[model samples]
Each structure stands twice: as C-alpha cells, then as structure tokens.
Target chain A: MLVLELMVVIFLASIVAGVIGSLVGLGGGVVVIPILTIGLGVDIHYAIGASIVSVIATSSGAAATYVKDKMTNLRVGMFLELATTTGAIIGALIAAYVSSIALELVFGVILLLSLIPLVRKIGEDIPVTPELVGLSKKLELTGSYVETDGSTVNYNATRPAQGLAGMLVAGLISGLLGIGSGTFKVLSMDLAMKLPMKVSTTTSNFMIGVTAAASAGIYFVRGDVDPIIVAPVALGILFGASLGAKALPRAKNPTVRKIFAIVLAIAGAEMVLRALGI
Target chain B: MSLGNPDSMNNVISKVLRYGVLLSAAVIVLGAALLAARDAFSPSASLLHYDPNQIPHGPFPVTFSSLTAGLATGSPDAIIELGVLLLLATPVSRVLFSVFLFAAEHNRAYVYITATVLTLLLFSMLVTPYIPVFGG
Candidate 1:
C-alpha cells in the first residue's frame, strides 16, 4: 500500500516537474528528486540514481525530435558538453570522499540560493553583440523558433561572457551536484547570450545526457548506484515526465511557476532540516 | 530575426526539437518503468540478491570500498552523489538561475533557489544505512 502511494507521488512529482521544466526550459529530474526525498521518503543515493536514469530517458526522448527538427545546435551542445562533462567527473570524484551530511547541507543551500532568478523576467528583447555579430552569421547559431504567437523568431547568441558564466555555474554544479543546470544554461543563452529561449533549451537538453553520462560512469564504477533504489524512481519519473510533457500545452505559465516556487521552497526547507538531522 | 520572430528558420528548428525531445522523453520513461517494474517484482528475487561479499567480490572492490569510505567520511566524498542528485534538482535551480539572468537584464530580486529536494534525498540515503529491506 505504501509502495503504491509512493508510485502516485512519483507520478505527481513528474507531472509537476514537466510543467515547470517546460516553461523554464530545464528538465524535471532535479525537482523530482527533492520531492521524492522530502515528500515520499526516498533516499538521496537512490533518488540520484533514479533521477540520473530519468535524465537519460527524458533527454533521449526529447533529443530525437529536437535533432530531427534541427532546433538543437549540435555544434554548440558539443562545445559546451566538454565543460559540463569535465565538471561532472570532477564532481563525482569529490562526492566519493565527501560526507553525505555535508553534501546535503551544501545541496540544500545551493537549491535555496538558485531560485533568485526564476521570479523575475529578464531581457525579453533580442540581443546584439559585437562578438556575436559574426557568430550567428558564421555558425548558424542564428536561427528561428515558432512561438505560441504563430510567429517565427530569428535569434542569435549574444554576450559570450555572460553565457560562459552561466556555463561555468552549470559546470560547477554538474561537478558538485550532478545536474544539467540547463535552466541556467538556457536562461544564459536567452537573456545574456541573447539567443532564443527555445533554441537554448533544446540545445541544453541535448547536452545534459552527455554531461550526466560522465558522472554516472563514475558512480557506476564506485558502486554508489544501487539498482534497487534507482529502478523505481527512474521508471516512475520517466512515465510522469512524458505525461507532463504532453500536458505542457494545457498548463498555464504563472500557475506552473507558482507551483514550482512553492514546491522548491518547501523542499529547500526540508533539505535544511534533513541536513540538520531534524 | 529575433527569438520571437514569427518566420525565422530557428523558430521551426525550435519547434521540431521541442516536439522531438518530448517524444523521446515519453519512450525512455515508459521503457525504463517496465524494466524497473520487472526488476522490482521478479519472482526470482533471490537472484537479485546483494551481499557484503558482493561489494568486495566485484572486479574493482577497492573502488567500492573507497566510495563507502568516502561516504562514511564527511567533507569531500559527498561530491560523488552531487551529480545524480543535480538531475533531480534541475527544475528548482532553473528558477533561481532564471532570476539571476533576468536580474542583470532589467534588475530584480534574484532568488538563487535549489536544495529542498537534495536535502530530502540525502536524508533518505542516510536512513538507508539504518534500514533493512532485502533481508539485511
């Protein structure tokens, strides 16, 4: 009976994850883990494994279409992947020696601090940069994406420094926490780099799997990945993410963001509590 | 063309990529679920047995033991679990990072959100060490 309830929780978490992830252009795996730990009483070790597996699943699922449509900048993804993959391996190596308690404390703090940007809307305009002037023209990074407005947006990458800073954050977190940090990645491209959000997100999605695989390999070799814990969460999340992805069009923006905010706030508090052993 | 441009080639590319990713996420989720269920409910449960010996018997027992030692220790070892957990925390961090970017664009609150979920995961894992499931 408890198992069944847990399954339901996982499903709900996935739906929530998908809705929020789609709007923000980050995948739902991060949201799902915290929910499972705080709400459903899942272990972080298992939770991480499950979440990583789901990352592969969801990325693969999404990448197929993104690649087919050519919205994903394979070149850009590949370029950035170098940073993320390196960071992930470094993170994995560090995790193996760190105390789980400290890990939780740090992770919770990062999560709490990471939310500052989501509440505000940054530059919604197209950006133009001298560095990017020849960039979009040369690499085909300049492209269009369809919007709900029924308009096509031709966008370019702007503010290479800003975008790189976001990537640096992603790399650190990937190494430190093992996430794609795609939200930051996409946000950087959209706001700082002045690329289309759609393009940024799609490309970020394409890159997450490679980033994760790097660290996951370390976990696999280290025996941190327990199949028992990984299987259910992974499978449950995948199911929910797909359903949520489908529900994306049907969901509202503010409503979803509010839900995302509230959930994270609670989860953030929970992380602090757990780390304190409360 | 801008990101919001109506007829740019990037617009079409974005839509294709979005849809394509959605489809792939679905299949990966469903297939993994089936496999997980099978593993969870298999009649030959004993075959899925785990023992202390299993840890040391592997091709690289030293690596496994070191992981356990790292986890048992307290400062740096915590990093290994960070990557997988990040995937789980990706959604929440998205908002925080978004706030950051937008703040610089027009200037705003900047929340820097993430953690609630990771705390929970760590809490759960810590407890895993105390509990017995498969007849430990």
Candidate 2:
C-alpha cells in the first residue's frame, strides 16, 4: 500500500512538471527535482537521476510533434550538438569530482538566472532579424515556421559562434546538474543567434534529448538511476508532455509565460534555500 | 548536391520519436505494475532515500546475453531497465537517422558532422564504462 502510494504521488507530481515544462519550453527537471526532494523527502541524487530521465521523456515527447510540424530547425540543432555533446562529457566528468553542496549552489544560481530571459521577453513577440552572420550564411541556417494563425514566419540565425559557445555552456550545466538547460539554449537561439522565439523554443526542445542522453549514460553507470524510481517519472512525464504538446497550439502564450516565470522564481528560491542548508 | 526531401526525412524522424516514446512508456508501465505486484509480496524499504555510497557503481552490464537471460527469468527490474535503455536509445536513434538523411542528401558537410555526433554518443554509451574513472 505504501509503495503504491509513493508511486502515485511521484507520478502525479511528474505529470504536473511535464505539463508546465512542455508549455513553457522548459524541461521537467526544474519542477521534478523540487517535488522529489522537498515534497517527498527523496535524496537529492535520486531526485536528479529521476529528473534527468524526465527531461529525456519531455524532450522526446515534444520533439516528435515539433518535428512533424516543421517547427524544429534540424540544421541548427544538429550543428550546435557537436559542442553540446562534448561539453556534456566534460561536465559529467567534472561532476564526479565535485561535492553535492557545490552542485546545488550552482543549480540554484542557474535556475535563478534562467528567469531573466523569461521575464524580459514577457508580453512581446520577438521580431526576427534579417541579417545572418557569415557562418550562418555559409551553413544556410535559416528556416520558416508556420504560426498558429497559418502565417509563415521566416527567420535567419546570426552569430553561429556565439550560439555554439552558449550551447557548450548549456550542455555543461545540463550534464552537471542533470537538467535540460532549455532556458540557456533558447537564450542562445533567440537572443544570440537571432532566431524567432518559436524556432528557438522548438529547436531547443529537439536538442535537449540528445544533450541529456549524452550525460545520462554516465549517470546510469554511476548507479544514480534507479529503475524503480525512474519508471513512473518517465512514463508520467511522457503522457503529460504529449498532452501539453496538444494544448500548446491553442494556449495563450503570454499567460503561459507569466505563469512559468512565477513558477521559476519560486523554484529558484527554493533551490537556493535548500543549497544554503535551510 | 541537394539533400533528399527534408520533409520526408522529418516525417521519418518524427515517426521514430513518437513510436519510440510510446513503446518505451508502455514497457515502463508494465514494468511498474510488475514492480508493484512484486513489492506487495515482499515489501522493501521506502524508495525515497538511497545512499549513493551503498549502491553498486559502474555501468549496468546490459549486454545482449545478460538481457536475454534476465528476460527469461521475468525479472521486473530487468524489464524496467530495458525500458530505460529504450528511452535512452530514442535520441541516439535520432542522431543515427540524421546521419543517414544527411548522407542520402549528398550533404557531405552535414554527413560528417552528424557522423561525429553519432560517434560521440556511441563512445559515451559504449566506451565510458571501460574507463575505470567513470565507474565503468
């Protein structure tokens, strides 16, 4: 009975995380970690392990739909993955040597920092810039995505170097912290590479699975992933993400973004407090 | 040279992603049900607290022979682990599919790039375990 109860609670929390994560273009880890740790009293390592699995679940679930819709920029995502995968390996190696407290502190800071982009872009559609940098032009890293209203939006990605650099850092943080690091990836595409918000978001979604997979192997090897714990979390998130994907086209963007910003703020403070041993 | 129709490639990839997630989720659900049933017979301690030090370290030995043996025994843990393996394989398969798509399009630059990513992914999954320091 207790086992069933635990599974139900964790499963429900994961579903909520997945819904919020898919709607806001964040992976479910941010919410999963807090819920597992603070709400359920799970150890941080176990929470992270399960959360990483949830990230892959949400990423794969959403990416499937985004790819079919032609919202994902495969070219850009593929190109940047080289750096991200390499950085993931390095970060995983570093994680083996670092202390948990230090990791928590870093995770807290990243969570807080991720909110800036969400808050800054609130209530406004980011305009597409016309110019592409030399590298972007050489790679032909531009694409068109159809909006909800059936209008096509074409966008060019500028500053390939900056985007790649940002992805490396994002990957590093993702592997170390066991989160999707989607916020950083979107910031790179939207702010640095000048991709449209929709493009940045979907492409980031597509990229996260591969990034998380890069480090998941390490976690698996380290025995951090418990199948019993991950099974429910992964399955729950998969269902929730699929539902969120269906609703995304009809949902109001500004409202969702505002809700996500508030959630992030609370999650960020909780992480900092936990890290401070409070 | 122009790559094969990017649209067709995207469709194939999307199908792979969708089916992969669905299949893995189904398997995990079955495994969870089995796990719950098994736990009912012999209840273990709470799942919430696990000591990192007490758990056996190193990559799970998921070779073909072991998986077959475990499946024959109907081990719930093995089934759950297999689902996890499939979940991980979804993205890895995506990378592999991209390699083929890039090659079919005769896009040499992307083929090489995608191949490199595939190699890195394989190395992490297959090679990382042997490198003692990574607990392989």
Candidate 3:
C-alpha cells in the first residue's frame, strides 16, 4: 500500500477505536492495538507504541471535559497516581526485556481478565455507606459531583492502601500492554476506595494520561515510537474521543458495555492465537 | 488567588488540557501534511513505508537539542515528535498544576502526595535513561 493509503487506513481505524473507547469509558488503546496488530498486520511493538500515543491523546481530550464538569476527583486521582506512575515505569522497563510473543500473550490474558468487570457489571452507582479509613481521612480524599439530573452526589474514599495496590497493578498492565487499564483503575476506586461511580470513572480517566505519559517516554527512548505512524493515530483518536465525549451523556451504558465486552473478547482470542503463532 | 479556589483551579487546568490537546493535534496534522506533500513531490524518496517487520526502529534519539534542531530545519518528523512530546507533557503539567493547587489550598497532605507523583513521573522520564538495567 502507498504511504498515504496506509495513513488514511490507520487514521480511520483509530477514529472508530476512539469513539467506541470513549463511549465505553475504556479509552482507545484496547481497540487500537488489536486493530493495528491483527487487522493491519503491524508489529506488536509498533502497534503498542501507536496505541500508547492514542491513549494519551484520548485521555487528554476527554479529561478536559471531565475536569471541567467536576466529575474528576483530583485529590484521589493524584494520590493514586503515585502507585500508577511507579508501576508504569517498572512495567515499561520489564517490557523492554520481554520478547514480543510473551508480551502478546500477556496482553491477551489481561484483555480476557478485563472482561470480568464487564460481566459482573461492577462499578455501578449504588448508595453505600462510606467507610473512611485513616489514610483517606488524612489525605481528605473525598468529593461530590453533580449528576446529569443536577443532583449532587457526595462520597468519601476508603482503604487507601488497597486502592494504591490495585492502581499499581493497573499501571503495570497499562504500560505492559500500552492500554489505559481503565477497568482496573475504576475497580480500585469504586470497590476499594469507595468513591462514587462518576468520580471513579472520571478520575480514572484523568489519571490514565499521566500513567501513559510515564511509559511513553521509555517507549520513545527505546525507538519503538514511529512519528509517521503515530501522527494519524493520535489525531484520529483525539478527534473521535472529543466526539464520543459529547455523545457519552446520551449513550446507554448497558448497550455500550455489551458491545465493548464482545469486542474485547474477540480481540483477546485473536491476540492469544497470534501469540501461539497462529 | 485562582489556585486557592478549587473551581477556578479546575477551570484553569481544564483550559490548559483542552488547549494543549488542540495545539498538539494541529501541529501533528501540519507535520503529517508536510510529509504527504514531500512524498507526493518525490515519489522515489518516500518518507514513510508500511512494513511491520522492517519499520524504522530506535535510531532517532529524542532529546531537547535534536528536537530543536529538527524543528529549526522544518523537519516533518521532528515536528510530529514535538507534537507527541507536547501531548505527553500535558499530563505532567497537570500533575504539577495540582501540586500548586494543593499547596495554595493549604492541603499539606495532598501537596505531598501530588509532589510525590510528579517526582515519580520525572524520575521515570529522565532518570530511567541512566539506569543500565532498564535499557533506557
């Protein structure tokens, strides 16, 4: 294929990934990586590099809207980021030494694991008594956000250490797979930290950019990043994510979750097959 | 004063993030256009080719000096790199901004937490290169 054709194809695919990702609150990397590697026949390393860039793009684009809406809990996000960033650095370094096939297998397994949350429909908004732990209280990691119906839902975080540990694992997967690991982050916040669903999702989105950025530099330094490939993917995801963010409020969560789960399952199976040299 | 107010602080950070994304995307589009134009004019001298196995790998070192030099010479690749750099920098800046915001609010615990996050981020970005085991 000609250079122009290739760019156009990647750009369009990235747009779809970004749109689906934003609507589902998963970010673009999951769709972007599978499409690039399985559909386009791109190398896993290069695909990961491009996916990471798209992750940053989508996160930054959507985060702007989330922050402004006050849906993001900055205090909670910032506190958890310490673990994520550190885990990202470690994961990226480990990735450098790991073989491509091994990385592909790991990615597939994580993709499959990500399905658990979707199946269980965890992280939904249910009124629960806030369990304020010592660390959460000390850090004052509590927040409230106005819902779509204009009702303010206030909440407090608990089990700070558990959330931090979960974030570390989430960050590790994100760096290793070049995806946002949004499911894991949300799980940590919603389950462990006891944050409201809105705050957990938005704050997780807010932290993803920083987590990806930490690992991206390492990827760039290792020469995995290609400017030519990244240009279209980044631009496409950014544009698509912005549109998806606009559409998110009106989109039905159950429908989006089902679609996202199906996509992830197929992508995971394909990745495993590829890893097994199929 | 703005930093002391959570609402204003969030507004400022949001604007920064939005503008940062827009600026980076615009720069990347410009660079992509330049690349396409260059290829169109000289078909034999293609700047991009899609070979998954033989794609360009790890030759270009990204540093401030090289980026500046490439931009000065109007190198399309460098321009694209700059755009990526700006995208990565946006999140880092947000963390930094949070540090100041927390400090202004006299939230000492959060100020410490944010600062720690920022420090870890910088360590990964800058200090990791010197560590031989990480192969940075």
Q: Which one wins on DockQ?
A: 3
Residues A20-130, candidate 1, lDDT per residue (tens digit)? 554444556667676756655666655665565556545544554454455566545544544554455445445546665676577567656656764564323333433
Residue-level lDDT tens digits of model 3 in B79-130: 9898998898988888888888888888888888889999988887777766
The residue pairs that clash in candidate 3, if any, are A223-B58
The stretch of ten residues in a row with the least summed lDDT in candidate 1 chain B is: B108-117
TM-score of chain B of 2: 0.77
Model 3, A198-222: lDDT tens digits are 5666687788888888777767776
If candidate 1 were superposed on the true structure by all CA atoms, what would the RMSD be?
A: 12.9
DockQ of each: 0.06, 0.48, 0.65
Instruction: Tell me the spans in candidate 3 whose CA falls farther than 4 Å from its real position.
Output: A93-118, A122-124, A252-271, B45-49, B57-63
What TM-score does structure 3 among the candidates reach? 0.89
- Over B1-136, each residue of candidate 1 has an lDDT whose tens digit, in order, gives 4433323333444344344344433443443454346546867643334332233212212144554564465312222233233333333232223333333333221111112222322332233223333001
User: Per-residue alpha-carbon lDDT of model 2 for A147-264, expressed as tens digits?
Assistant: 7888777888888999999999888887677777877787677668877666777788788888888878767755667775688899889988888777776655466557656766
Sort candidate 2 into its docking category: acceptable
10 residues in a row with least lDDT, candidate 2 chain A = A248-257
User: Candidate 1 chain A — worst ten consecutive residues by lDDT sum?
Assistant: A121-130
Question: Can you tell me the CAPRI class of model 1?
Answer: incorrect
Report the poorest 10 consecutive residues by lDDT, candidate 3 chain A.
A248-257
Candidate 2 stretches greater than 4 Å from native: A103-107, A110-118, A252-260, A263-267, B1-3, B40-68
